[model samples]
Each structure stands twice: as structure tokens, then as C-alpha cells.
Target chain A: MSKLSVIDNKRCVGCQSCMFACSRRDGNAGLSNSCIGVKSASGIEGDLTVVVCRACADPPCAKVCPTNALIPKKGGGVRLQKTKCIGCKLCQQTCVIDAVFWNKEENKPVICIQCGYCVGYCPHQVIKLLK
Target chain B: MNAFNDTLSRVLYIDVKNKKFWVTERKDLFDKYIGGAGVAIKLLQEECPSGADPLSPENPIIFAVGPLVGAFPLASKTVAMFKSPHTGDLGESHAGGRSAVAIRLAGYGAIVIKNASDMPIYVAIHGNKVFFRDATTLWGMGSSLTAARVMREREIGTGYRSIMRIGKAGENMVSYASVTVETYRHFGRLGLGAVFGSKKLKGIIISGKQTLQVTNKKTYKDLYDRIYKEAVNSQVMKKYHDIGTPINILNLNNLEALPTRNLKQATFEYAEKISGENIAQNYLGKRVACAHCPTACIHLANLREQYSDSPYFYKTTFVGYDFELLYALGSMLGIEKPEDIFMLIEEVEKFCMDAMSSGVVLAWATEMFEKKLITENETDGLNPEWNNTKTYIAMLSKIVNPPNAFYKAMAKGVSHAAEIYGGKEFALAFNKNEMPGYHTGPAAHLGFLIGARHSHLCNAGYSLDQSLLLTQDVAPETIIDKLIDEEAFRQILSSIVVCFFARGIYNLDLISQLLATMNINYNTDDLKRIGKEIHAEKYRFKCREGFSFDKLEIPGRLFETPEPTQKINKEFMRAALNYAKEKIKCQ
Candidate 1:
């Protein structure tokens, strides 16, 4: 089992390289489908927050899903069962860290699948995969 | 058209007077000019009325991002074009933050804001919907930082947004007012803020989540990885990530090229105290990067102040500082302390003014006061003396609010102030816009005088001076030729909208390769031709706006001060300008 984790988020520069890479994993060139998000924690003068799935063992998002669309993975994160999802957004609401992103065009949840594609793109070495 | 090209060619035109917005397919413009500065100048010519007052509703504001913006590293800058209230001609500025990515993802290669709004408003573009939100409350905000924070709270798309707003300086229509992008970055040259003020626009909030598909996904990914690796590994980029741009302070000071005390002296006596290494070691809080950029070059300094009223209470502020900021607010003012520099930087940031212009203006005013050309009454009882941070801070506010006619004239720029006050000889400005912090040699000044936007970055003459002129004596005509060629080449880079810091990383060959991945096939020769054409077009707009190389005033202080080479003079400068003018005409 493996999980993606922020190594030292203080080093993060809010470049969104991780977010871009996550989106690029789908062979896309934009942020429409990225599960990761980075933004200023306060304003531009303050620190940045790199928001990714925290990989909870007993995930709250899975419990709230009406159709069990969010299947808990072996490590901690969950995999989306697209057939079961009805786009109610219950999983989005229940995710404590707000990591269950949305596909606005498809009205589907875009959860990080713990593939670790973004780890290679973190220029500052702020994120890594724990195996 | 390909999907990428189709999306990249859509231009959003907003008519604030009519409260109407529409998208036009500008594939022809993008096809010809690429995007950013190249496409923006074309749009400006089409929209702006001839000889229109820069602050009038007729002067249009255009923001353009390139095709490489969201897809490539370092392609993070957005080119802003308008008629400058400062220079009264072809106003152009570039800002890096999230602006390029936001504009790109918002599905617009360019956004042209036309006419004046009926009331104070901020335009919010979320995907396809455009909302003109009443910004009456936010209009007179004291600090641009506060305005940006308020806008952040009010707007949607926290993760995917770029908020650009003006502060009191902009709202008051100061000629050198800048539009603060995010909090750390800005369209920090010319009078874009004054243009925003004239239009009654308080801010613009842009955010979107549109997906972009490349012609070849494998190629894009491979190119992206290679570029990313190169950016991180490049020694030049590593220098930026470490000490950032402020590293130039010591180097310039050592070379005796740093403009100090209003160019009265070339080197500051206390340069080391406020050097980049000093700031990074002592005050550096964190480093940040623009969207999609691997090199996190933006350095913010932490200044902790204990409340005088409450002994135990302490407040810390993070102010972005760069080489230009350090030069403009530090050495140029003769300020010896780094903390004082930070304080001045914060005030300038709060006012949303161009730091270079603000510093040059204050330096001139200080010199005037020293010469007894003007009394304290002119400064509203504040004496603008060198090394006095308190007076400078107060003066910064006065420039924004403008208590007296002197402050009003000063707010316009150093050149305007000198025109009225009889200090035109020492007014360090090129074509009415304040000079950037570079007094390297003849080429640097020549670049400032002849460059399309009258900007140092327009051709980077200082870099040329250091690399070429310092090594050997070069003919003025040859220098002009080199400057023209470099400036023309930069037109393509700015169109691609890469941060000039990454100029070495994104050369013509690499740019061609990257564009190939996106299905916009243009070889080096085509790019070279287009670059020259764009440069010519910018000059055409400038000439139409009444700019002339022969008529430009050469600052006497530049000749008096000792640059590294010590060969700069009026005659050589005039001859170079003439040659450049003829060369541009031939082009």
C-alpha cells in the first residue's frame, strides 16, 4: 500500500506544479481534473496550503456516500466507483480536508488515486509517496 | 482549427460603458502574432482611438496570455497593454502570479476592457459568466494588500483565481499607479492603475477550470518534464531560487553601476547593509512561484514590528522584495538600513505604485529640497531628505492623496515634476516614464530611450553592457543593431508570455518544439520574422501616439554619474538613437 504525503509543506511555493502534473496525468493541459489544489493560506503575503487527500483509514467521505461510490483503498485513500456515483456531492461535503474535488463538466468527483504522478513534479520536494 | 488553437484564439471583449461583454474569435490575430504583447498591441490599435487622452474612456486596456501559458513552465507572465497616463503612449507591463493561468483557463487568450464604467465596479469572470460587481466600498481602500484580501474573501475559486486591483494611488489616478496582481506581483510599470481609475474599475477577478488538450499528449508531457528538469537544474535559475534578483545589488554596486542618491553617485556607501544576501539571511520569510513555474523566484521578507503602544504586542508583515525594489527604495534613496527599505517597500506596495517611478520621483524631490529649489511648504511640511524613511512614507501617502499641487505634479512622474519645477536636467526618466534601476552604460540608457515601451526589460541593455561592452569597446551603431535585434526577439518571448527570467530556458528552438506539441507549428525562421514584425507594430503604435527618438530628453545626471565603462555621453546617445530610429523605420 502507498500514499502521497506532504513532506514539508512550508517549502511549497504555490506554483501549482503538483496540481498541473495531477491534471496532466490524464493527458490534459489544464486544472479541470486535478485532485490536488494549492492556494494562499491567508493572502498572497502568507503561507500556502497544498490540499491533497489526507488518506484517512476510516474515511468519512466513504461513510457519507449514499451509493458506496467511494471505495476505501488498502492504504487509506478511496477509489471512485463511477457507476455507483449519482453526483449528489455527499462525498464532497463529508471530506474533512475538502480533497474530493469536482469535475464541473461531468459533475463527478475527482479523487487522488495515490498514483504518485505529482511527486515527480514537485520542484521543491514538498510532496512524496510513502510506500 | 485544432481544439487548442480554437480555445486559445477566443478573445473576450468587455464594454464597461454598455455593461456588455462578448467573445470574438481572434484566430487571425493569434495566428499572426501568437499572443500576449504581440496580440495585445493589435487589439489596442483596433480599440483605442487615435490621440485619445490616456486617462479617457477611449483608451482601452488589454490583458493577454499566450498559448504556452498553462501548458508550459515559466510561461507565467500576462502582458498588459494600454495607453499610459504616465508616458501617454504604448503602455505595456508584464506581471507573473496566477494571471496567465487564470486568463488561459478562463478560455480567453486576451481580455480587452473598453470604456468607462458608470460606477465603481470590479469585473468577476467565472468561466463564461461575467459579473460587474459594485465595488463602492472597496474603491478607496488604503492598502492594496487589504483590497486583495477582501477580494479573496468575496470572490469564488480560491484555488484557481487571479485578483488584480488598485489601491489609493490608482483610485486617485496617479500617473505611475500600478495594478497589484495577487499580493506579491504587479503590473508595476506605467499608469495601468490610472487607466483603471479613469474607468471606475476597482479590480478584476478571474478564475476558471477549463481543460486544455494538446495535439500530442506524449510530446507535451516529455517536453514539460525536460523543461522542468532544465529549469530546476539550471545554475541561473538556482541563483533566482536562492537569493532571488536582489543578488544584483552587490554586483551592480561593485561595478559602480548602481544608481544611488538620485544618480548623484553610482555606488551607494552602504550597499552591503541592504544587499540581497543580507536580506535573505536576515529577513527572508519564504519563497513563492507563479502558476506552473518550477523556479520559485519571488522572495518575501519578514519584518516584525513591536507595537509602540503595546510593548508586548508584536506584528509581523511579509513584504515582497526584489532587485528593482531594493534599488528604487534602498540605494537610490540613500537608505542604509534594510528594515527601512522594507518599510518603504511595504508603503509603496500598499499604495499600488510603481516602485521605480516612486523612488525616482522621491529622489528628485529630495534633490530639489537639498538644492532649496522648493521649500518644506511644497511638500506639505514634510522634508523629503535622503535616508529618511518616515518622510518618504508620508510622501508616498501624499503622492496618493496629493495634498498640494507639488505632490500632484510629483504623482504624475519625475519628468512632469521636473518640467514644472525646472529640474529636467537631472530628471532620470526616459520619455516621461521614470527610469528603471540601471545605469550600466550607454547601451542601457539607449535601450531605455529607444526600447518600444522605454523599459529596461524591453531589451535588457544592462545585461548587454556587462557581457559585451565591459569586455571590449563596441561601436554605437553596432550596439543599436544588437539592441534592436534583442528587443525584436523578446517580442516573441513576451508573446509566448514566459517570465523573462526563463529567457535562457525558452529559446527559439525550444519554443518551436513546445509550440509543435500544441499544434502551432512555427520554425525558428517564422518566429524570427514574426518577432521583428511585432516589434515594428509596437513602434508604429508609439509613433502614432507621438513618440519620437529624436525628441527624447537625455537626463544630464546619466552623463554626470560614472557608469562602469565611463563612456556614456549625450552625443553618443543621440547618434545611437538616430541610428536605431532609422533601423526601426527600415524594419
Candidate 2:
């Protein structure tokens, strides 16, 4: 079984420290390349939702990839092959969770690799690794 | 590297006396200070001669942003450092908006302005070029809001532009003047606005749009999304977004730490009237946000009321209120009416004064009146009363311009006024800077006294004291030790230009990982070592300016008023000071 990044929204402070950390992990100092999304409901923030790839057994993103760039990994989830991607965003539009973040600079869709780097930065114990 | 390629291109050095501009790329300084307040502090220490008059032409004004500013999320604050006209010591303030982004994108890490202009002028920084335009028309502007509106319309920049302009208070050089950015947010502490005024610079307008570079693009995207998710969904930011900082009122009131009626008492008698819940229920009109901030914690409310003089008339005014503003201008001034507090806040904003200091000054004036120090004659025939928003507004306006002796005295800040009037004991200031809202325990007071910059966040001593109260009998030494450690750690965070709000999220291990990604090598031990060094450097500057923690005045009122942990003893406080002196000496 492949591990997935799990989120517990209750403990998050919305500092965006995790976001910066993720960007730094990629050798960037900005947020343009992050794959996760956090948005508050209405103007109130008590109920914040953390959205990330669910790493499904049968991912919808893989089915919509025209060039078959997105292939299911041996562990459990799907992976994107940048060389095969035609800059087509059909998979991005089809992903129900909106986990795929599009990089405007590169014209490519970014998805969470299920790496646990972000988990340690979450001060609230909101993010956990799930098997 | 070309000026365009290097992030630390060149510090724009402007000598106000000759109105000359020059640039020097201090790469070594950038590598060490890492820009923002860290760089500003170094510049202040080097340029500002000892005992240089803070309001004189000799005083240097510095504006700085970090290396990661334009390239990152949450790295959005521009730090302004100067010799405070109020504190007579190290003065530092930070404001968020498009200021940091604009400065960084404009390709400079620091802008230092020295000397005074013979006439009013405004500075415009466009890429590599700098222009100083005559602001004869904009001078003596009564309202900063109007100035910002006019500048926004006239300047060739918008959206990503930042306008930092002063109002009547600044032009008049009020001791606690603040520079307002984006019309609402302010670099609102010490007297940076006064420094601008001293330079005969009415305002500064900056704008830029430059794309930042990133390494390991794939990993960057993944991390960005992860952080954005947590920021938008985190419970820690919920309170800030919902009630804004005003929520601290309820929490502090419950803790019995709220400074009320000029620190005469801990909790206010009419605490409910000024609680965040009350303000949100009655007057929370709209919420605004800083640039690229997902939290949107800025709350501006409209208070509509029927005018007593007009038959069928109503006045609608927009006011921003938070915990510190409410505590300082409302309860601290003995004003219980929410509408009254809102009205006073509007007056402060219009004149562009530091709300905290203004409130403390008003409170001191009110106390002076009650004690019969000065009568109606000294007050220009206007009776100084508590909670009278109408009278308070009138007094504030008169003081900003100061047409008479009473108004002029009031303009000099509470500490100076108290010194002249012989009430230093209850002047309510730390290092000549007015106190913030936290008057709950020894931790808060001690933190303010000992913290390098004397800011609430330096060590958040009040919060520490509260935590200690819950756990065990916290000895004075334990409190001092904890505060020193926290303050040291915070120095490292600020050097990295990380916001204090994210302290919990950016632990030592996470910081190490993040730095690794940036190709900067550091570990937990490195952070501690660096933090200690930064803390020591700040103290070194403080000592150079003749600051002694042992010589620090512990206001007599603190001993009289019982705190949440119980009334602090003088002996214990003395012992704590002695220990702090030794600890600092060892550093």
C-alpha cells in the first residue's frame, strides 16, 4: 500500500508556513508551485478545508490523460510523466477533488507526490500519513 | 551580476540635505542580515550617530524588505527603522500590503533616507530610476485617506503599488506619528512618520511587477499546494479571520489581564461592551485583506447614527477596531460606549496617529484632569472628560495641529508630558514607548521592559505568564529565562523574515528542511546559535544606546494592581532584573 498525506483541519492555524516549506522543498521561495489548496468557507475561518490528492486506487485523472502521461504507480497512486504530457489539462478538469494544481510558468499540472515533507511543518498535527 | 539579476542590487542611499541619491550594492550585508528588519537594524546602527537627534536632519530613515519577499507567500511585510522621536532609542516598525512586494520587485533590498529636505516633497522609485517630486500641493494634508486617494490616482502605479503617506499628525511631527500604508494598514509604532516628516518627505509611492525564480520546480509546486491548503483550512487562523485581533479582548478580560482606566485595574468594569463579540454583533460592517493574504483578518466596520443637530440626517463612518485599539482608546480611556470608541478610532485614523500611544496619552490627560493638575484654563477651556468621544475627537484634532499650549503639550506624547508635569511614576511607558494592551502579569510587563524593541511580540511575555500560572508556581528567574530564550528564537525567525503568526508551524526541524530546499545549510543547533548571536547583537545595540535592564523603571502601579498570577512583589522583580543583567552581560 502506498501512503497518502492526510489532513486534520481542526488543528491548522492558517499561517501558510507549510505552504512556504513546500515551496522551499522545491527550491523556490514562492507559492506558484504548491499542489495543495486551503480555502476558508465564507469569511469565517473556523471551518477551513485542506484539499490534496486522495491517491485513489482508480484515479480519474489517469483516465482523462490524452497521451497517457498519468500512469498508476506500482505502490497505489498515479504519477505524471512530464515528457509524455502534451500540456493538455483534461485530467486537471476531470479530477473531482481539484487536487491537480496547474503551473502557469510551465503549462503543466502539479499533483501531490504523497511526500511527508509538509506533515512535519503542520504545527497542529493536522497533516498525517495514511496507509 | 547585473543590478537586475542580483536581489541585493544596491541600497538606495539618499541624503536629504543635498537631495542627492546614490546606490551601493552591499552584498556582504545582504548575505549576513538577510534583509528586512535585520538589515534595517544594521543600517540604523551604522548611520545613526550616538545621541543624534531623532527628529533632526541627522537622523536616518530606513525602509527594507527581505530576499524572499517578492518570491514567497506570507513574506509580505516591509520594515521601517529609525531613531524614534518618542523612544530616543532603537525604533522599528513593520507593515504589510504591497510594500514589500513593490520594493523587492523594484530590485532593492534597502532604501536609506538621511538629512531633511528644505521643502515638502514626495519620492517615486521606478525600477532603476528615482525621482523626488515637489509635494507643495500635498503638504499639510488634513487626512491621510485623501492623500492616499490623490496619490493613487496621480501615480503611474496601482494594484501592486504601495503608498506610505503621513497625515496632519506627521507633518506637525507628533511624537508618536505613524505612516499609513494602503490608507488603512500602518507602520504604526515609534515615530517613523515623524522621521519622514523630518526629511521633508510627505509620502513615498512604490510599484513593481517582477517574476521570481524557483529551483526544483516540481517539488516547489507540491509544497506550495500543501501550505496553501493548511493556511486556508487551519483552525489557528480561524480566530484571526473571524473576530480579528479584537478577540484578544474577551480572552484577556477572562484572564483578568486587560489594562483598564490607565492600568489602574486589570479587567474593565464594562468589559462586555467592548468585547469582540459585541463589536462584531453591532458594528462589524466589512472585512478587508492585505495583498495575497488568504486569512483576510482586517475588519473595517461602519457605524451609522442619527445626527443630533440635524432633523432627518444620519452619518455613516467607516472604522477599524481590534483588541489593542479597543483596550487603549476604549476601556483604558474609561470609555464604555462602543460607538464612542469607534468614533475616537476614526479621529485617530484621520489624523494618522499611533492609536496605542494616543489612547495612553488621553488616559494620562484625563487622570491629570481628575487629579486637578491642570484645569480648564490649561485645556483651552475644553473640559477633558473620560468616554466623551465628541470632546476626545476635538482634543485629538487640536493636539495634532497644536494651536495652543495645552494642545502642544499633549502632542509631545504621555511620557514627555508626564516628565514635564512630574508624574513619571504613572506615565505608562516602556523605554519611552507607550505600553500595548497586555497589563495582565509580570511576564507582559517584564517582556516589554526587557525585550530588545519593547514590543508585545518580542517575547509575548503575558502569554508566557498565563501558561506558567496554569502549570506551576513560576519563579521570577524561570519567567526571565523563558522570555530570554523565546526572544532569542524570535530574533532568528525575524532574521529569516518569517511572520510571528507562523511560529508554531515553523519549528526547528521544519526550518532546517525549508532552508535545505533554499540551498542554505543550517540545522537545529545552527538556528539556536544564530538566534543567540542575533539576540546578542540587538542587545549590543541597545546597550550602546545606554539601555540597562537594572535601571529600567518598574512603574509603581504594577505592584499595586494584582495580576492573574497574583500581585507581583517588588523584591522578586528586583531579583529578576539583577538576574537579567547578569544573563545579558554573559551574552
Measured by DockQ, the strongest candidate is 1
TM-score, cand. 1: 0.98
CAPRI docking class of candidate 1: high
Please state the interface RMSD for every predicted structure, separated by commas.
0.9, 7.9
Question: What's the DockQ for every one of the candidates?
Answer: 0.83, 0.09
lDDT, residue B226, model 2 = 55
lDDT (10s digit) by residue, model 1, range B293-321? 88889899999978889989998998899
lDDT: which candidate is best? 1
Most TM-score-accurate candidate? 1
Per-prediction TM-score: 0.98, 0.81
Each model's total of backbone clashes: 0, 19
Per-residue alpha-carbon lDDT of model 2 for B411-435, expressed as tens digits?
A: 8787778777756777788777788
